[model samples]
Target: MTYIIGRGYGRALLTPDGIFFKGPFRRRSIPWAEITEIEKRHHTARSSEWWDLRLVRANGRDLAVPGAFTSNRYDHKFEAKLALLREYWQRAAR
Candidate 1:
């Protein structure tokens, strides 16, 4: 049971078996096994939010999770989320 604190109403969570995300206009889950990669994308000049989470799936689909108000703005929260994601991903790899 893992939860990533959101800056606003959005939230990202990692359970024992999968990842869950709920945002203003997006809500979805990626099973640990189906996740292939997680990446941080560069923010545009127009965007103050410097970081975003890109979720890659085994089927080649990609989902972008905005961490702007919450995870990206604060001190290393994005990294923290990444670490947890990696941990769960490793478990799935096994």
Candidate 2:
């Protein structure tokens, strides 16, 4: 099974093989074995506040899954989707 989440200019696609990220101008594919960590991080800018999923690779590179962007209202489904993504990652890691 595959799961996809996100809106606007970025999205994250979770699959049994890996996680694929589609950003505004680039795309990244990280295989399950190459992923070292998956974390949720809080971000605050001058006018934007949101939370995102951060994927850390073995080579020390970080990728942000920007599905939780909350510019005006909160995205209530963010946590649920985050949990689902983690589940996929854990299953692949095993």
Compare the candidates by lDDT and give the number of the best one: 2
lDDT of 2 by residue, 1-94 (tens): 1222334567778899998878666687889888888887787879777676778889998876756444434566777777787898899988
Score candidate 2 by lDDT: 0.74
Off by over 4 Å in 1: 1-8, 24-26, 46-49, 66-74
- Give each model a TM-score: 0.68, 0.73
Q: Local error of candidate 1 at 2, Å? A: 25
Task: Write the residue-wise lDDT of candidate 1 on 10-79 in tens digits.
Answer: 7777787888888765688878888888876666565454566677889998776545323245657667
Candidate 1 TM-score over all chains jointly: 0.68
Superposed by TM-score, candidate 1 places the C-alpha of residue 19 at a distance from the truth, in angstroms, of 0.8
